[model samples]
Every structure is written in structure tokens, then in C-alpha cells.
Target: MTEVDIATKAPESDAQQDSSTNEPTDASQQMGEHEHCVTDRPTPAGQGSTGEIIKLNGVDVYISKPTDYPHTPSRLLLLLTGGTGIKSTNNQIQADIYASEGFLVLMPDLFGGEKAPGGKDTYFADNSTSLLEQVKLKAVEIAKSFMIDMWLARITEAKIMPILHKVIEAAHEEYADAIKYGEGIYAVGYCVGGRYVLLLAKGSHEAGNDEESGMVKAGPYIKAGALAHAASVTPDDFKNLQAPLSLVCVENDALFTDEVRKVGEDIMTQDNLEHEVQVYPGVPHGFAVTGQYQESAIMDAQVTAYEQMLAWVKDH
Candidate 1:
């Protein structure tokens, strides 16, 4: 088997979010991935408790625990919202995959925690439009309510980007203070979340080492990222990413099927960015999750990615 271990210090990846230029708070990244996780305890040796909705400065965030976890400090993952949105994210099939492997998956509700059962969503090209429109509209309300500049205030945030950054910091803080669930972390983002991960990536500059060539000597921090079906990010949009990063795409998706994907690949490669790009065969846009008509190769590809990710974490 061709084992593609994407970096040194073990794991790595990189990301970005949104077309409109808006500034949000910074999100921190941590290191560590595990084969098992612990439950029924305060932060055990390498295990931390997950599964709770956190309120950081008034932002309500939700984290889902991985199933059948073996118990380790902590592992983190993300699912960015795209159009038509991923209504509810506690799906056993999806949640257990990482939890069983020892991860605390954060399915943040960028959109007020509205839960959806599931189904088909092909005709809506405005996939993220649902949430994006929300932020746009909310900006107005926030400005009116708080008496501030609409666009400027919106960029400063109370929305998705800020919430995401806060979540990262909150994860770091929780593990730091918690008696359990305190291992390292890595993030996985899809669509909007994928884009949001990049924002976290950009944040590396402020936190130091945005490319995340390896783990910071300080300790277990979110060390890498895996962005699936990501959106575009200009160099200036986000901070420097310190974590190693990956961007995955389904072969049939028009958004990144050709030149666009290559451009993203080129930027990372030229920068000697710690990252990888995998385009699974015969899969459409949201192949990793539901969205019907998914290919087995795509599913296997995800498994391979996580395995490689675990390996990278160990090395780090």
C-alpha cells in the first residue's frame, strides 16, 4: 500500500473560508490523534471528556463524542456547513467513525443549532446560500441592535467565523483545564466549515507557525487539518496556518475538478506547505458524508486519510 504520510512532527494540513473579505477572531490549533479514548472520568492520563454544548463569551457550541472510544486525551474534528446545510450532525454512522477512533468531533452550529434529519439536495447551487444569507442578514440586525457599522461590525463577528475561532480556543482551553479529554487535536472541515478551517489556518501566523510544519514544542495543540470539498482562499484572507493540512475533493465535482484544485495544490506545494490533495474516483461533491451515490473508493479514501492522520499524530 502507498502510505502517504504527509509530514514530519507527524501530522499536517492547511485551509480558508468565504469570498467576502471579513475579519474574525483567531482559532488555535493543537496536536494529537489516538487509537482509543477514555470515558467516565475527569481528564484521564490521555483522555478528555467531550459531547457538550459550550458557551464561550456567549457563543453556544456543540461537540459530539466519538462512539466506542478507547479513551485518550482528546481529538478534534469539524464539519463546515455548505448550502442546503447538514441539518443535524449527531448521525451514528458519521459520529462513531472518529469517536471509535478516539476523537471529539465538534459539529458547531454556525446556524443556531437547527437540526435536520437528512435527504437529497442537488438542485440548489446556492448550497451555502442558506447560511451565508443568514450572516449577511444577521449583520444588519446585529448592527441595528448594537448600533455599529453593519459591514464592519459583521466582519468583526458574532457569526460563523468568530464562532469557529472561539470553538478552537474553547477546545484548547477545555482540554487544558478539564480533568479528562485533554489530548491533542486535528480539524476536518467540509464546505463552509472547510473554509472556516483555513481561517484557523491563517490564524497560525498570529499564534506562530501558521504552516504547522510540526508540533509546537510547548505541548499538545491541534497539529493538523483535513479540508474536504473546500472553498477558495486568497493568501491574505486568513492568517498563516501552523498545522499540517489536507484538502480532499470528489472527482466529479465541478467546483474543484480541474484548474481550481490545481491552483490550490500549486500554492501549497510552492510554499512547501505540509499538505496533500486526494480526488477520489466517481464521487460527487459531498461524498464523505450522505448525498447519496457515493463510491466505495471515496469511503475507503476517508479511512486511509484518518489512518495516515493517526500515524502523523504519533510521529509528532
Candidate 2:
């Protein structure tokens, strides 16, 4: 459970879509043709008490509430998933874990109906005799697969932002008293989910339009956020961040590379934003959510990262 601050730096990761980054304005114009992709929300897995699915503004959201929910002033969090979406067993478990810690968790189906092949342990290799070999096998699996590319194409930041805003607005209305009591919203993201949290942390602003006046926009509906093994995030994202943030980085990641991290830290510092970056060594991407925890290091880092996020929430 060791914590290494971003005092030093290093590579890019697989399952990444960097260099050409988030331009939500362009995406907004192209939305009409792809409305079907963004509008088609998925149904709940009906897994009993793990969580419950409710339609929030026509989007199916998996919600995990604290036992004393509504009766207690518990903070609310939007649990953003990786490529696995909300129905994945790992995300459900994660929502429950947050609930147990006294936070009402809401996870929306960002992928609509489609989800990654594996749930939670999506990166684990099959029948690997050793942990190191398993890591290698998983690397090959990501490298050789077309799923990441397809996912990038399907889940653009522009398409998902409106859905997230709608969910936040609906959740705020549905739990008005509870949210007012606990203050406001917070967010947590894993991998692809990580990218959105960054966008959210930037808060709402005008991205401009065809008119000279431009349209005002709002979003993310979060007071703060935390991210683990974020993918496809660019330097500009960090520069634009307006809310406090905590980042959990893995030793080996192609998506959130060393250069990218350094740039992020520099920009965050220059902008005078509150942020903390911690690195967990000897692990692959997605280790925070889906690592093989039987191994001591993996388990320790996973637990430590979760604690780090919780601490950030409480501190702010």
C-alpha cells in the first residue's frame, strides 16, 4: 500500500487514443447522425441488492445507496466505469463498496448496451502459470485486439458528456434533499472512465459555436474527482481542470505516459489547481479496478488507491 507522489517521472499505454484528443464541439455537431448510439441506454442486470437500475432522464443508471440513504447526509459520487460499462460485476461491486463507505454511488451505462468482453478482470490472461507471465499475456491481448479501437470510435467524449449531464441533473432532482445535505457531487473514474472525470473536473465553460455570441454550457456536476489509470487524456485537459483531483497511476501505462504525466503536473501547478498524483509500481493498466488481487502487491496497491480516492473526497 505504498504511495509514490509525482515527484519524478517516464511511456504510452495500450487501449489509448491520444495525440488527436477531445474536441467535444466537433462531436456535438455530428451527434444527430449518431443519436441512436448515444441514446440507447442499457438495462440493469437485475442482480438483486448489489444495486438498482432506474431511468434518469431516459438513461439507465445503476445506483448503489448507503444503508441509511435519505436518512443520512451521505456524499454522492458518479462511479464511471472503464470499457466494461455499469453492469459489469466489478463496477457493481465498486458501487457497493462506495455505498458501504457512506457514499451514494450512481453509475450510468456509458456504452449503451455494449460492454467489453471481460467484466472487471477484463485484462486478465487465461491459464497463465505465473503473475509475470499473466501480465505479458494480457499485454498481448490488448495489443492484438481491435476492441480498444472500436470502443474509442464508439464512446467519444462529446457524445457521452450530454448523457452524463442529464444523469447528474436528474439525480440532483431525485435526491435533492440528500445532495443538499452532503453538499454536492463527486466523481471517480477508471481507464476510459478516467478521461471523462478529467473533462468534468474542468467544470463547465463555453467551447464556442458558429455564432459570435456563442452558447453557454454547464456540466460534470461534480465538486471534485479521482481517476485511476486514465486513458486518452491530453495535456490541455489538465490545464483546464477547475476542481480538485486525485490521480492513481500505474508504473506501466501507454495511455497515460510519463511525458503526458509530467505535462499534466506542470500545467496543474501553473494553473494553481489542487491535485495529487500517486504511482503504483509493478502493475498494469486497470490494476486499480480489475487486477488479480491474489498477489500481495496487486491487492495492496488496489486497496491503497481506493483509500487515496476516499481521502481526497473527505479532504475537499
Candidate 3:
């Protein structure tokens, strides 16, 4: 599509004010317009360690930096939190793990401080010897906890994407030593966050492809992207996917079913987009972030997914 077409179709600016917090959300604010405020934020007691919370362009971000690295970390990872929101203990722990692996991980609060109902304890699988039964039990719990439509209405692509764009722009400026604009930046998303990652990748490609008259100079918003058990993804998302993409799915996820996944994969293959998909057996949606990690099966699948994502990001 032409630059004009892309510009016209681009999402309108996000809501002028956040509905949940009534805070001004001026996503276009210049990075240098305000100084960043870094505060020692603590996660719930005994949950795990999360990096400090920093404000960038009006967004609250949880950033974890790897320590004791021989050299400065070159990779910048934008982690999108699931519907559990950014403050979930599991989400923070996940960020910490990524940081330990030498990634500068930034997880923004997609929900502007409004609490999400389900959290780390959402997994409802009991000692069901049958994997199918376990998946069903987990699905029921997730459906009960998450009001998907309401949350989707509140955090539409139009509402969240601009905020994310500004967050990234500010991140490039804030972490200039470690991350250069359009270089070495990657994203990983879970559940709702996964869908956002796909949008980010699509946006990066559409904006970058139009070199002469693009909105900004043609460059990637994110170098590559990965997702686990992404919710609300459609086959259309794969039509013109640009960046290298990877997906980790559970075999029995209601959100990301086998048929839907196949359709998307077909589209990506037809477009010849560089991408990979791996579906682990006998787990439900949210297996990566919200799974019952105490279970050996769930823990193994989650670890494998994380490793797959890390390998893909590094390879790309």
C-alpha cells in the first residue's frame, strides 16, 4: 500500500484521557519534554524481584536490567503483559528472568493502574490425571475471571498502540546507550499482550515499508517479535506480517485453537514471511505466564516456550 493509504488507515490517536485513571494520555509527547522519574518500586512481598518503575512519556514501565554482564546489554525487549496487567507477580518474575538472560526488559502497564481480576492464581487445574480435563478446568477458570469483551473495549488497538509507540520512542531516548532506534529491539507478549505484539510487528512493517513518505523515517519499531498463547488473534493479522515472528501455543487453548493457528500459518507461509510456530501438547491458554508452574508438565512447557522465544529473538 502507498504511504498515503497507510497513513489514512493508521489508528486515530489514543483516547485523550485514560478512562480508568482520568489521566492525560498525550502519546505524542516528545521524549525530551520531560525528565524521567525512576522510583524503587516493590512487587508483592515474597513474590519475586522486579526492576524499578520508570515513567516515560506518561507511561509507567517496569524495567529489569541484567547485572554482572561482561559488556553492556545490547538487546532491548518490550514485554507486553497479559490481561493480568503489568503488576502481576508472575509477570514481574517473567521480566526478571528475561533480564537475567542479558536482555534489558521493559514491561509497560497496559492497564493504567486499574486492577485486572484474574492473577497468578488463575490457573485452576487440580490433580486431574487427564491433560484434557486439566485444560478444561483451566479454561473455565479463565473465562470466569476475564471479562474479555469489556477489557478489549477498554484497551483497543487504537487506544494502546499510540501509547506503546510513545513508550518506545521514549525508551530509545532514555536508553540510548543500550538501544538505538530501530535496532536490537524485540517484543514478547502473553495472552492479550501477545495480540499487541502482533500489532506492533505489523505496524513496524507497514510504517517502515513506505520509505519515501512514511510517517517517520522508514525503520522497524521492533526488530522481531514472539508471543505465547496470544488471545484474540485473527488470520488477517498474518496477511502482510513483516518482521520475523515466532509463536508458542498450547495444544488445547481455546483462545488460540489449532484451526485458527493453521489459517494464520497458511497466510504467513503464502506471504513468505519468516515465522515459526510450536504448539506444546496438553496445556491451556495462558500456559506460558499464568500456568500452574508447580505442575511439572506446565513448568516444562513454559520453560521450553521461553527458551524458544529467546532463541528466536537472538537468531533474528
Candidate 4:
């Protein structure tokens, strides 16, 4: 599609805004001027041992460097939250594992900013006013509203600005504890964040492909540079998918059935780009980082994916 076609439409609609948050929103403000640059500020806490975690607006984001190597520089991995809550035991381990691999990690708290990190249950209504409390609680409704605003803003930036800022600070914080990393950059994610890796990748690529408009918003087929190296059960962004892509789906992810995932991958493969879809046995949605994983198998898969990506990056 042409820039004229994409730009003519606004950035977001009312329901699109609702997917990320639960609040009465100013549709105009929700689609604030697109952030062209990362914010200039100190890193947020739980970041580098020396780094800080601050609120990007109201969301909690932790930007940190690897504390082990302390002297070398490294690449970055921006970890997106799983849409409903704070770090899960498995996710925390995944982030730490990446750090151990000599990469900087940015864990943005998309919901903690709203004081309602209640996961899917966050939407569960309270019933105390009477036996039948059909009315939505004012407080729950309020948090939901505010959250949507922040959520949309984060999507606009992906985790780029925060990850960049962290790398800068970590150069000082863990100057010696780093490793020589990928020359330019790449992204990996999980759950909602995994989906984000694709969206951000597409946004990254879409910016290049659809130059007239400059960037794709947080919408369908709006992702840039994501098809390649992206891990997901759903890969329907077939036709417009631009990156060298790979897909990993759980054995039992109902919404992400193996057939559907393959269909997505098949589309990419037919596009003549490198694309593959593999499903793990006994895996479930959010199962990629658990202790139950076969260490050798997982490691082999990781190496394969990373190597494939580096090679593709070299050619692309």
C-alpha cells in the first residue's frame, strides 16, 4: 500500500485503544505525535544492578546492563510484558537467562503503572455492594481507563527508547561485565511481548518500506522487520510480513493451532524469505521459558534461531 493510503487514516480507533487499557480516553491524545526519538532520562529500577526503574508515563520499566562482565559492551533484548501482569517466575528466568547470554535486557511494566497488575482476573468484577453487584466498581473501572492510555503510548515506542537508554547507562554501570555483541541489533520477546517483537519489527521495517508515511502505527499488518526472528503461534501477517521470519508455537496453544501457525509460516516461506515453524512437544502458551524445557533441545533451538537471524541480517 502507498503512504497516501496509510497516512490518510488516523493512528487508532476507539476499540483499538481499548485492547491495551480500561479507561475513558481522548482518542486524539492516545495517538500522540509519534515518538521519533527515545526519551532522555535515567534508566528505571530493577534494571542494571546500578540502573534505575522509572515510569514511562505511569508504566514501570526496568533498564539494566549485565553486571557480570562489567567491561565489555553487548547487544540488547527488549522484554515486553505478557499484557496482563508483572514478571512471571518463568519470564524472570528468561530475562536472566538472556542477561547471562551477555545481552542488555529491558523489562517494561505496562500494567504496574496502573496499580492493577491483576492479570486476566483484573477484569473480574467485584460483588460486595449486594448479592448481585451488576455495576462496575468505580476504582476498577478507573484503573482500566488510565492503563489504556499508557499502553497505547508504549506500543508507539516499542521498547526501543528504553533499551537504548539502558545500554548507554550500562556502559558505565557494568562497563566490565559485558560481552561483545551483535553489531547492529535484534529483538526477542514472549507472550504479548513476543507479539510486540513482531509489531516492533514490522514497525521497524514498515518505516523503511513505507517511507512516505514514515511509520506504521500499532495496528494490523503495521509491524515492521518482524517476520524473521519472531517467535509466535500466530503468523497471519503473511502478505505484508517483511522480515526473515521463523515461528515457534506451543503444542497445545488452542488459539495458535499448529495448522494455523504453519499456514502463517508457509506464507512467509512462499515469499522466498527464510521462514520455519516448529512446535514443541508438551508445551503450552507461555511455556518457552520454564524449567520443564529440554535444556539441550532448547539450547539447540536458540542457537539455530540466532544463527539464522545473524546470517539473514548479513544478507538483508
Candidate 5:
């Protein structure tokens, strides 16, 4: 597998200087001119606890624990939200749900908390938009895959990977006791977040083979990963996936079409990797996190996807 030197340390550059000079007070300040940033809004109160907002590497992440946390979580779940950004109610709901299930959920605002490039109001109010509109918007987003891929590439190289390293480092330090005895760290992401899940899995895989790889030294602690309605992922992304992975896709999702699914399946099978790819019929992209369950069929699919993710984490 060909590896990109993501961990290479270079002399301080102008971008580094800019980040230091313009420290973000809120999530919005984290966007660069060419980068897409999700807008900041009042996140709904996470169930039970509102969650603690902590800054790591100058980026803000909300950490929430189960109210009934038995002082020991089975694993730490790094929940990466889709392109809509981290503060969305949809994202909060998923985090709360995971926490309720006894997992420590850490959600970092990957877009630096800024509203995405198109505008600040691009996001629909959670549980407010009609299912029809949700489906249409998802399709539109998928149509822009080329542009989104470019944006993702730039952000991943410039910010996402480094922030990931820091988040893992922080999690180990903050939850030292729980992680020390827990099953291990795991990652779950939706849409664009899915792309990141693959990246981490690949990095973990590379690091496992080469102890000198920067990922091993940084210690992300990710034992396995799962992604749903992933976008902009190609076969190359899975080349170095070291841990077990589960991919949950919606049959009708434009971003994760049959062709994309085939590529993933073929590569993993050829490589003899431990992984599973599941596609649910008729559901659209964003079903796992944003699907309104008014329809019984959609509700069942969403429930199944979530269960699959939880099961994958446990099994691995």
C-alpha cells in the first residue's frame, strides 16, 4: 500500500502562523477562504448532560458521557459528524444515543466551526424538514461530490489528521483509567466523516506494520471503525485499513452508489481484509443520523444501521 506522509513534520509555514494568530473563539473562526465550514448555531441540549466543550489543538470538541456511566465505558467512540458540521441537533442526538448505550462519545467540529461555504443557513432545522426535502438535499450534496472531494482533501491534509491525533492523545489522557481496561478506541462517522474514519483506519493499519510510522508514535488507539453513508471515498482509501471495518450504505444513496460499494468490496476481498459492507434497500444517504423515522420502513433501516455499528465496535 502506498502511504501519504501525513505525519511528516515540516518547518512552520504561513498557515500555521495564521492559525496561531487567529485563534478561534467559536467554531466559525476555523474556516479558511477556500475551505468549506459548517455554520455555528445553538446545539440542542444533549440528553441528560449538555456535554462539556473542550479545546484541543485550538479546536473545540464536545465530550459527553452517559448519565448512568458506571465509571467504566466499554470503549471510546469518536463520533465524526457529516458535512453539516458538529453542532447540529442531528449530531447531538446520535452522540446522546451512543452515550446512553455506555460509550464515551467525542465530537469534534472538523470544519473549524465555520458555516460551510455556500452560506450559514444551509443546514435544515433538525426534525423540522420534511422527508422529501431531506432526500432532495442529500441528492444535491451528492451531486457536488467532485467539489466536496477537493475540499475534503485540502482539509484532511491541513487540519483533520492533526486534530485527530490530538483528539486521541487527549482522550487517552482524560479517560486514562477507562481506556486502559476498556476494549479499545473505535470510530464512527457519517457522510464526510466516513471518509475520515477510513483515513484513521488506514493510518492505524500502516502504523501496526511499521512501528516507526508517525501514527504509531502518536497513538490514535483506534482498534476498529465503521462508516455510514460515506462520501468521497475511493478504493485507495481502504488500501491500508489495519483494523476490522464495517460500511453501512443506503441503496438509494447517490454518494454511496452500487459502483462505489463494488469498488470497496472488491478491494477488501482482494486484500483478504476483515470487513463487512451492508447496503439497505430504498433508504437515502444520511439515513443513519438524519433519517426521520415517521415511516416505519425508514425507521427500521435506521435502527438496523445503528445496531450494526454498535455490534461492529463490540465484535472488533
Candidate 6:
């Protein structure tokens, strides 16, 4: 395991009005303008770290930098939170782990600043809510009405891709200096976010392969990607993937089954694209994030996944 220095700092607060937060006055007007606010922030208590939050394009991104590094970081990892949204403690733990590994980590709010659709309380339900629960909350009627695949389809079409574009642009602008020397840009997604990571890799290639679609591309910047216990990815999703991809799957996961993994693998193989699929035995869907159950096993899997992700990014 990589050693990380832990530091504490008082949170900084800054107030800035971003046009993106304003209500649109006319149809001709763009929905939102680019704006960002930086606030000194610390990692969740017990994590022993400090960083900042950047409000960009109307979304809050939690950024953490590695401490006691001998040299500047050469890579950036954009972490996408699962369905429960960015406020979950599980996400924070993963963020701290990634930051400790010496890469600049930025986590974007997947809900795009909205109150999660079905109601935040009903969705999250409890601190122990697993990745599957967040995506399929029993208390939320809407979640029950739609199947996971359909829900992911709608989310990918409506929110995930668009928000990803905004976040990428904001990261480029906000971290321009630090990114200058960075070797490459990478992404890691959990649960629903995992599907988005696949979409980004696919979309990047799609924008180049198909001109008529007019889709925004994440290809030029993101060179590698990984997904942990990802939900709702299908064979069709991998048709245009252009980057090296690694998938960390759990054997006990109900959402991403063996068949689902096969679908992605088959597609990548046919295309002769670079990809890897590692299935860890006896763990659930949110094994990498939530630490409520199967503590020892889950923790082990999380570490292995993190190491795999870092190695994949560097190798690519």
C-alpha cells in the first residue's frame, strides 16, 4: 500500500455568483454559464486530510491532493459517485483512498445539483444503504416502477453525458496549470457512475466515428477508464470504446452478472480493443465503497481494485 501524509486545515469559504445557477429568462439563452468557487475543505473526519470543493458548472466537485509527494502528479482521476449521490460517506472514503495514492482526485456530483428525483431521504434511506439500494430504493416508488436497465438508459440519455461534458470542461479550465504536466486523464465510476464511464469512452469514439450524431466527445482528454461494480452496462455500450478499460466486478453482485460481463468482454474482443475484467469472489455490488458488511473481504477488494485502477491508468 502507498503511504500518504495526512494534514488538517480549516475550510475556506468563497461566494461567487455563477450564471449557470440563474434561472433561464429566454429560450435563446444558454441554460447556464461556467462559474466556479473554491473553498478550503477537509476530507471526512477520521480520514485525516484536507482539500477543497470546487463548484463548477452548477455542480459541487470534491477535490483532494496527495500529501508528501516527492514530485508533481502526472495524472488526474475523475471519480463519479454512485446513485446515492455525492454526500454519501462511502464516496468520501473512496475519494480519500484515491488521493492517498498520489493522483489528484475530483469527484463530481452525479445528480447535477438536483435533489435526486425520488427524494433524497427515501433514496439514501440509511447510512448502510448499498449501491443496489441507492439505485433501487424500496421506499421510492419511481425506483420500483422502472427496471435498472431502463432507468440507466434514461439517466445516460438525459443527465450523465451532459453533466460529464460540463465537468470535463470545468476541470480543464480550473486545473489547467496542474493538468499541463499530467501524463493523462482517467476516470473511475461506481454503480450508476460506472455506466457513465463506459458511455464517456464510447462517446469519445462515437463523436469521431459518427459525424451525424453531434455528440460531445470525452476522448481527447480521457485516455483511460475503470469501473467498479458498475451497473447497467450492455454489449452495445462497448461498440465504440477507444481507451484502455478495466472492470472490477464482484462475484456476488446481482446487478452486474456473469452474462453482463460477457457482453462487454465479447464486444471488446471483437473490436480488438484493450480491456480487462477481474471478478473478485464473494463480495457484493458496493464492495468497493460501502464498508458496512463483510468488512475484511470488502476492504481487501477495495484495495486490490484501487491498485488495479492505478496500474491501468499508468500503463495506458
Candidate 6 lDDT, tens digit per residue, 1-316? 0112111210000012123323222211110100000111223345543556778777788777778542664457788866656665556667767777767788888776543332212111233545465344333434332433344455654556656667777777776654565655688887778877787676354454333334455554477888887866676777878877999986745557688788789988988888998998855455565343323555577678878876887677
By lDDT: ranked, best first: 2, 3, 5, 6, 1, 4
TM-score winner, 5 or 6: 5
Q: Which ten contiguous residues of candidate 6 have the minimum total lDDT?
A: 30-39
Residue-level error in angstroms, candidate 1, position 222? 4.0
For residue 246, give model 3's deviation from the true position in Å. Answer: 0.9
State candidate 2's TM-score. 0.74
**TM-score-sorted candidate list, best first:** 2, 3, 5, 6, 1, 4
Model 1 / residue 69 / CA error / Å: 7.4
TM-score of each predicted structure versus truth: 0.55, 0.74, 0.72, 0.48, 0.69, 0.68
Minimal lDDT window, size 10, model 4: 33-42
lDDT of 4 by residue, 225-263 (tens): 222122233554455455454455555454345566667
Q: Report the alpha-carbon TM-score of model 6 versus the true structure.
A: 0.68
State candidate 1's TM-score.
Answer: 0.55
Candidate maximizing lDDT: 2
Q: How accurate is candidate 3 locally (lDDT)?
A: 0.64
Candidate 1 per-residue lDDT, tens place, 208-282, comes to 442222223333235566666654334443234556777666564443346666666676676676776777664
The CA lDDT of each predicted structure is 0.44, 0.66, 0.64, 0.41, 0.63, 0.59
- Please write out the lDDT profile of model 3 over residues 1-316, one tens digit for every residue: 2333322221111112123323222222110011000011123346676588889878899988888532754578899987666666668788888888778888998777865443221222223225675455445544533444455557677566766876777877787655662266799998778888887776334454333322353444677999987877788766656778999987755566688899989988887889999988854456566323334675688778999998898787
Model 2 residue 241 CA deviation (Å) reads 1.1
Q: Name the 10 consecutive residues with the lowest summed lDDT in model 2.
A: 3-12
**On a 0 to 100 scale, what is the lDDT of residue 249 in model 6?**
87
